[model samples]
Target chain A: MVTEKIIKVHAPATVANMVCGFDILGFAVKEPYDEMWIRLTEQPGITIINKDDYQLPAEPEKNVAGAALLAMLEELTQPVGFELTIRKHIKPGSGVGSSAASSAGAVVAANTLLNGVFSKEDLVRFAMNGEKLASGVKHADNIAPCIYGGVTLIRSIHPLDIVALTAPPLFVTIVHPQIEVRTADARSILKKQVYLKDAIKQWGNIAGLVSGLLQSDYALIGRSLEDVLIEPVRSILIPGFNTVKQKSREAGALGGGISGSGPSIFMLSKDEATAIAVEKVMQDEYQQLGLDHHTYVTTIHSSGVEIIKA
Target chain B: MVTEKIIKVHAPATVANMVCGFDILGFAVKEPYDEMWIRLTEQPGITIINKDDYQLPAEPEKNVAGAALLAMLEELTQPVGFELTIRKHIKPGSGVGSSAASSAGAVVAANTLLNGVFSKEDLVRFAMNGEKLASGVKHADNIAPCIYGGVTLIRSIHPLDIVALTAPPLFVTIVHPQIEVRTADARSILKKQVYLKDAIKQWGNIAGLVSGLLQSDYALIGRSLEDVLIEPVRSILIPGFNTVKQKSREAGALGGGISGSGPSIFMLSKDEATAIAVEKVMQDEYQQLGLDHHTYVTTIHSSGVEIIKA
Candidate 1:
């Protein structure tokens, strides 16, 4: 039932809520993504081929990719058939938006195979449904930047106002240690209420980040990227977050903090050399703990989802 | 006591927070300021000439303009004599940073007469001291705009991160009702702790406001300009705040909100005519209440503090 068309899809890894931009901003990584081969078939039912070692849900409706596709197809009455094979690169729940990448990637590939019936915005909306089923909250910070390249600012959740920012060239380094930290646990540890003083500082930092991104002022961006609200609560989950950040700063990174609900930490630098340096420091720390990990030195990626072998 | 040299100073009115931006952002008003005339004299001490009808403190440390001058003089060792005259324009406590204007204007004018020793940044730092004395808390959202024109993002209070933003061409309307709301009372009424859900929404709106200003998308700017954290708590002090906002939206305003600590409401529009229309509607509401008021229809001001006659 396989057709003559075989398409390779690349969905870039993304760091959600970059530092002070918790739940409101995100940007795409330039390298190391979960690759998938998607092909249309003459048969009526959707199929999933096993590729990665990680266990996936057998039911298509429960799988992130499958759930997203099902949601997209629900809008269309015509029976659509396709087989998807996913190669997981970024580990799930590493605070690097692994599920969002899969869900967003599948929808992008499926939409392209369907001749682009739904818009990119619609794709993001559909992907959020997948996230909702996964995490129980339809937060757009992770899904938006993965879908639309560069830095994305999610201004509102009710009507979902998301603006794609033209990012300056930033060296992004993400360190994912071989550890487990559930997002639900991270969310639970946060205090039910925060001081207004801290809230003001956070908003100020948000304004600074937005202005910094727009003007392409790297130093300003670095200075504005401090988190007084979320990072204080979340960093406790990561053993050496403060030490990693300090080392990264000493190694010429502008600044960095916990990536998403993290077991991963990310840093921003002015150049690739500095980014690599930060990565080395992270690796050194992980090695001290005698743990395996992965590090990526990437830039502000302007390209997002791509249709390969069309 | 008046000497030969006459120094004329102008301080632009500022809109603090610009809708969704609360306590962490502000921008300058182009025209109309509290102008002051200062003259070096042979007289041994600082003296205040006839100015506004109100009996402003003649003691340099007790008065806003006098405090600014004293702060400026602290840097200069040589004892100086001066006569200061004020032409008050910006109404105090209207939330358009009226005190900030007077303080910034005084320092700028004094610096002009003193051969320009203090830099703009230094002036802002000194003015923050003056603001601390005035409000019992040191914050730069108001003073930064008055000292450095255009939109200013105060990212932190400890290290004092401030970046001035060059705003796009947009019409502005500000209405100040002849009612006083003390900053201390406004500060005291708010609860110390806020719900996490509200904080999330506030941060989201702030991120939206920042992104909106950078992109220069008017509708996006309007949509993102929502303040859930501070506005709700603060608006209770101002009468007819909700109605004015509703009417302005009906009159085709992009958006509007409380200027700063309250009693003044500011709105932004795409054109001058609409700006005028919005102001008229706000004024009509004030008129209906049989209350005295003042309004300004202006644009984004690029000029900060300047000496007209040096």
Candidate 2:
């Protein structure tokens, strides 16, 4: 009955905690994705192969993709097995959702192998297991967008209420310097309490940002992309963040902030030209410091995981 | 050159702070508006008269409407004068934007007399003077919606950025329990700092609410009307608040909270029948306490200020 069993998927990179929308908003980008292949087997366990230079764990139990697939398999009524081959272009700890790309892609492919047995929400829940293993916490900001595509808002995590938000055409520019800012350290550095006055301003900016995105008001979007609470604290961890942000704005980006914690920064632009121009600004900053970095100029990826070969 | 020398305007009441969107969001309701008649005076001074039982100040500086008009006149390139006659239906200290009605109503009528010179945002700025006179701060949560005629988000007050958001059809049920909760007291009772975890939840709810309204997702809206920050402390100020909210939801209301500071509560419903049912639920709770209350079941007022007689 199994005519063809191998499935390959392209899971795009996502930028989580978009500026003012910390721990809630994210969107997928077209490039810098992971290439994942899943083979449905008669055996009832997960196997992972790392085809990239990052040298991720090949052991199924320790791997991000393996853990996520195992979680999905645990919920299935039918016994199924998956062998994942992940070719990751996104480097782990680069803060561009490298683990998310692999985990979300693995689940999407395995779900296809099972004839789409799970809802997208369920996939997100499964993927959180992978995220927890990677970051020591269960957060869906990156997973939701990587699974559902485009922009996503994780309203509540307890009941898992996620909303796919509409957005205008936007180009994303990413600059990931060769550095590591652990998610735990970044989170620990944040104050447990925030001033109520500052919180009000943050909510105002976030509400305005959401309104601007839904209405396609570009100027308003640009104006509302400011982050008062997280940026002030997290910017310290990322080297040359202030200068890069200032120079990028001078290069015509709408606005952006630390992508998923730190070390990697994302900027939103209106056009490909501006995106590329901002990319140049990002590259030059690290180049002057003699630090190696990678940059990508891409647009919003509407379809989340693409079925490359089925 | 102005043809319409005299104008009789109706300014609707607004529900501010809209649950989680403290100091940011609000919406205008259809009924319980104030009636004001403004005439272009030959003399360069503002005048006022009260035709209601609530004996508010009448002097230009002391009056809410007069202070708002005075603020507008100071910014005018040309000297203008206005004479006003007031008939207020919304009672002061009822927490439903009584001062905002008078302030926005006066400026709107005067703008007509001066051939519509001030922009809507400027009108909000001027009307904020009245709010400052009433409450100890210049907040636009009520003024923006009362002038812009829908759900309005005050993005920033420094430069006066306000956004008018689109929402689906919703019926508003208001029950004004005859008690005064001074805006200062309600604000002062709140902690100057909030837990980052609670703030995140509040922002998530507010972001969800905005997305829900934009997408017309009624279920999401209902689920997101929760306020973890302001409501917990302020709900105590309103008698029978917990029972009324609990019973209204049971009676098919979506959800809602304190109108502005409290003492008056508002609930949103899907249809007129549900709205009326929620209204009865609201009335019964206050009546059981032997508290005199006024209730109104009305839809969203699309146009904030209406010229009843021109």
Candidate 3:
């Protein structure tokens, strides 16, 4: 017998950094999410009906949502069929945790349809597996924040220890200049070995960011939220990235950097005015470049992944 | 005519790592410091005056304080003869910012007696020069904290930018296992290049420490306070280093590592009882090692340097 159930989920866009945190930290946003609709079918196969028709993968093993739902089912004792319809709102390869949103939303929808068999943590693990299948690396710094919400720090990758940091009352402004830069190409250009001095400088910034966050010393946070090591190397791949960052800082941003493996830039501010100011600067820069872009001014999210409407 | 004036000053002990802040960030201990005294002479020549005859450099040019003071005098129009008498309390190379104490104290004393020509910042700069003379490198992670009083993060060494971190209420337990490890030898033994994987792990820990300190997440702080890259190479120089760390952890330390370039190990705890517990464990381990050792159980010093009654 086919158990027909419709479940809807929203996965927020995320700024992968608040300055010093590169691949190891991120926070979720309030709008511009990837919504997914999931239902269980009697047919023992996986199929993705790409409602947005964004040339998304339909194969269960290949698609992010499909891969995650299949991974979750693989852990189940009984075989099941799933129909996942992904509505891609967060742009693909925009450095906005796109794959994370799809994976998170799918697993959440699938698990919800199955009467919530797997725990939230189990969902994160399962989503990570799907992420690995999609991105070829199992990094959860971005995914955890998208799924769990709040400012998240990934202490380790092998053991996958994720901690939700105490969220400061803040806003995040993100700009995705519609320039395409493949993640694979972006990863290839970075030098394998860095100077010891650069490494130490990066550590200092990390330390400053941590202390700033804890003390709510916004100025220190702004001062410390600099990426001397990774951003310099990675920003070269994104057009007008340096300008955006400079302009954003001028616009009264605490600080911002290339979001995730960019083509997108993110700005973090203490208030809505600063966030809006950052957004305007980024938008103005993008308009001058004649590149279409998307922007978000968000607060620090304290919640991760949850059922939206079922 | 000779003017004999007494000055009393205190420099705080500092924690090098706020969990993941190893080697890159440190803050001052507010109290329990090493004290020194300086006296001017009209004998028309520099004189040697070591109170305890602790085998430090007796020649004005060779002494750390003397070297720094001489350097400062060289920048001035007037060159004066003086005798430095140090009533040493903070043990040298104990990783409680000892060299920092001497370097900073010397400049403070010299600057004070020189009619207050140099500012506190100028003193810090001069002391760092002394540090460079001693360690063959000019990094102010330790010296700035000792001089400035609170938590200080050395962001850049070349264009030296020091950011003062607002540290929360914290307790510290420092144990100096009497085995002497020369800073020169400790530095010499470190390998030039570490594995990329290990470097990545180290960065994650740094990020964690920064976040842990910022949010005051004690558990996160403890978990992030690890050094897989530099510590392993440096720890080989100190006997029973690993044992003390493991035992201290078991005894409830939030976590700690080698104090500066050590024979000293420092741990942070949330409370006095926990710090005491960790200190006892460290002391017991040193006793078991059959080594004559000393341990200081104290708290995080919010103040850096102070002038006390002579």
Candidate 4:
């Protein structure tokens, strides 16, 4: 079953907590991704190399990538040792699914080295183990999109029901400010209990967003891209968030909000030109705040994880 | 603006609190509507005639139908008197939008006699005044669908934004048990606070249902019709509710739950034959409980409020 001597895979950065669908929806972006190179070894466990500038642990069990590979290997009948080389393009704590990209990339690379032993859904499960190690919550919001690509809905976590929604061809603009907002800090800011009235509005907007995506109604998507609950709390942690969102909409973004937790924001547009224009707005808003930020204008990643070289 | 001499309008019954969309979504049914006949009068207020078995108030300010007409009249620059005759077909407290039908029907009849003076949105606002009198809550769940037809979403109440969703051609089977479950009782039974986890699952299902309706995916509709919150509490009040739902699913219903509050349960099927099959299941379960129930096999009323004769 081990057909490949060496395998390299790429997993794209994902956007989680999508507007009205907090903790239940996500989608992949094309520009920023984490690349992993893996090769079989006689050693019993995973070994990491070329983790430049990153302070990730070299020990297999302690590393985010190693935890995912270990989880995947534990399920295999014919297990093999792997030596991984990670080239991290997505920065950690950027709120752009940096951890998910690494976790998903590692499992995908290991699965490829084993000649694709695991299904996409199984890979998502295994990748969630890495998420648990990284963020202490085994959430699939980022992992599902990183594994399946496109917009994905986590219908129920108890049964692990996930549906990959049909999305129109659209461009994405992301701006990651050079600041750290821990996932735990962002989550702790949220109210433990929400009003039933606000929850009803949230679900309605979620329904509208799903319809807009499937129907390719840009205006509907724009109108539906509103969050009444989570954003009001978590957005306060991100500096210039209000200005960035307003300016992006003013510059003709379909709509957008805080990407995942905070420190980064994303906007969706119908065309590349609008996406670029929206990126400028994001950049200018952050610049006015005297913050260093990185902007990426790209389309949605439809092809999730893929073997780049084997 | 008072151009017409007489007008007769029909407002169809509606299903509210649609599964995961509690208090925010509803759809109109074709059969079992309330008809209103209205004519301009020299008197400055609404007057009622032809009272049947129903004990509805005759006073324009206190009556559900009259309250809606009064609200509409308050917005008019040149208010006119109207004499209304309501032919009630939808029984009160049936959980099939009886009050909404009366309220929406009255405003529609009055608007027709005035040569279509108010928009549908304005009519919904006027009709909500009637809802406040009927259920002590100005909810649009039932009223929106009765006014707009098809599946409708109440996005936000503060701004009064409602979206009319596209739905597939499907048959509905409604069985109203001859027992009343007051709307106040239904509201009191629900927990003021729900787990954040369950709320996330609910919103996900709502999104899935909207996608299913718009895409005409029957299986998706069935899969998404589940409720993890409200039905658990309200279904306890309805006799043989569990058996009816299980048997209907066995009989090939797309899926279903309580129609609005309780006593009336509705099932949706992709075909008329399946709808008829599902209805028998409902009848058998209710018969076993020794309860008299009324069943209606109908389709979604696409054209909401229609002027029968003008």
* Tens digit per residue, CA lDDT, model 4, A1-310: 8664788888899999788899989999887988888898996778888566877778878888888888988887775788999888888899989889888988888887777768888888988988899888999999999989999988766677778888999899999999889998888778878877678778878987887888788888898899999999888888998988898888899899999897889999999999999988888888888999999999888878778998
lDDT tens string, model 2, B13-98?
99998898999999999998999999987788898989988889899899999999999999988777799999999899898899
Q: lDDT by residue for model 3 over B1-310, one digit each (tens)? A: 8545766566556655443455567877654476776667776445656665467877876767776777777777766766666766677767666767777877777667776898766777788776777777776777788777666777666666676655457788887877778777877776655544566677778767666665567887788888886687778877788888888888888788888878788888888898889888887887888988888777777667666644
Candidate RMSDs in order = 2.0, 1.4, 3.9, 2.9
Model 3 TM-score on chain A: 0.93
Candidate 4's TM-score: 0.92
How big is the positional error of residue B133 in model 2, measured in Å on the Cα after superposition?
Answer: 0.7
lDDT of 4 by residue, B1-310 (tens): 8575788888899999777789888999999888889999887888987456887778888888899999998988986899999889899999999989989988988888777778889999999999999879999889899989999988767678788889999899999999989988898888887777678878978987887888788888898899988999899999999998998999999899999987799999999999999989988888888999999999987878789998
* Model 2, CA-based lDDT: 0.91
Interface RMSD of each: 1.2, 0.5, 2.4, 1.5
> lDDT for every model?
0.82, 0.91, 0.75, 0.87
> Candidate 1: how large is its RMSD?
2.0
Off by over 4 Å in 3: A1-6, A17-19, A39-47, A75-83, A110-120, A167-171, A269-307, B1-5, B12-20, B27-32, B38-49, B69-84, B107-123, B148-151, B163-173, B269-290
lDDT of each residue in A34-106, candidate 3, tens digit only = 8788777789768898878579878888887777777788899988888888889888889888888988888
Kindly report which residue pairs in candidate 2 clash with one another. Answer: none
Better of 3 and 4 by DockQ: 4
- Model 1's lDDT to the true fold? 0.82
Could you arrange the candidates by lDDT from highest to lowest? 2, 4, 1, 3
TM-score of each: 0.96, 0.98, 0.86, 0.92
Extract clashing residue pairs from model 4: none
